[model samples]
Target: MRGPRTQTERDDTTVEIVYAAVTGVLLAGAAFALVMSPVLFLGDVPITTLANLWRAAKITAVVVFAARICWTLRRFGRR
Candidate 1:
């Protein structure tokens, strides 16, 4: 049974949440771009293939984003 958080602790948590969100978005974007980069270099790909790649990129981005946020929060909480 932990006591209520102090003001500083609450502030720290808020900062951590924002930090996690920012970093998560950046990482997710990078992952998405990396996954979709092949589309940029391959000019003759079929539309279906492009669609599949886009889907994969979106999935990768979502997974990366969630993973990053969870990782950041877990790491911060241990402090």
Candidate 2:
């Protein structure tokens, strides 16, 4: 059976919603970066540096996000 919800649970739900909104922004930024990674045939300009930077940031964001979720779960489980 489902347990009664506490203030902490409500807070976590709010946090998760904020996290979801942030995720949309992150995905949009990543997609933009991927598209901009390659250049048109200028015959001189190399691939952009922002791609690598954005890629690294994306990976880090995912890891930290998973950690945040775990933290939220722990908080919810507590009395």
Specify the highest-TM-score model's number: 1
lDDT tens digits, residue span 13-54, model 1: 999999999999999999999999998899789999999999
What's the lDDT for candidate 1?
A: 0.97
lDDT of 2 by residue, 1-79 (tens): 9789899878877886676557655665665555544543334453465556556667765665565556655655573
TM-score of each: 0.94, 0.40
lDDT score, candidate 2: 0.60
Clashes of each: 0, 0
Candidate with top lDDT is 1
lDDT (0-100) at residue 32 of candidate 2? 51
Query: What are the per-model C-alpha RMSD values against the true structure?
Result: 0.9, 6.9
